[model samples]
Target: MAEKASIKCPSCGTEVEKPKKTWPLIGRPARDGSRIKLMIGQFECPRCGRKFKVAVKKERIPPEGR
Candidate 1:
């Protein structure tokens, strides 16, 4: 199962949901030999209304019964 991605705000320490819209920033291989893409974007905290950076790690899922 894929894990839900999330990151905390550095200023407010609020658990913010990962941004659905993002641009690729970096690419690297994971320990499991899967290709992982690092995405970056900006988001505003709903509670504090503070803008902050949002980073998300994306990996490809293998076909079922692989």
Candidate 2:
């Protein structure tokens, strides 16, 4: 199973799920469109309604066949 990723609310230290929205901060998609190379995420803390940003990068493991 793929591991789930999460970030903490910098203000409150509460664990939060993936950001509600994301914008490409840098990099571009591979020629094959397999993934987004990099991005910046905007997250809102459900507990305090605080907003924050985080840098995100996509990575994957090669298949066993490789």
Candidate 3:
């Protein structure tokens, strides 16, 4: 299940939007060696204009019509 990642601005304390980019989780790799198993997200606060990064857990979605 893909849960919503709560991104809050540290300076203004406002909830930020979802991250635009995601990278593979540190030290953890997918078994396939190509798929992304665990990952983190990078977000920028729109309210304070501050760039921040947070660890986010996301599940991979399978393609439709299996």
> Which candidate number would show the highest lDDT if scored against the true structure?
2
Stretches of candidate 1 off by over 4 Å are: 27-37, 58-66
Residues 27-49, model 2: lDDT tens digits: 44455544444567899999998
Query: Model 3: runs farther than 4 Å from truth?
Result: 28-38, 58-66
Estimate the overall C-alpha local distance difference test score of candidate 2.
0.73
Pairs that clash in candidate 1: none
lDDT by candidate, in order shown? 0.66, 0.73, 0.69
Cα lDDT tens digits for candidate 3, 1-66: 966767797788889878868787644344644334467778888777888777777455333333
Worst 10 residues of 2 by lDDT: 57-66
Model 2 lDDT at residue 5: 66
Candidate 3 worst ten-residue window by lDDT: 26-35
TM of each candidate vs. truth? 0.54, 0.61, 0.59
What does each candidate score in C-alpha RMSD?
A: 5.6, 6.4, 6.2
lDDT for residue 25 in candidate 3, whole number 0-100: 60
How well is each residue in 1-66 modelled by candidate 1, as lDDT tens digits?
987766777778787775545787644555665655556777767668777766666556433345
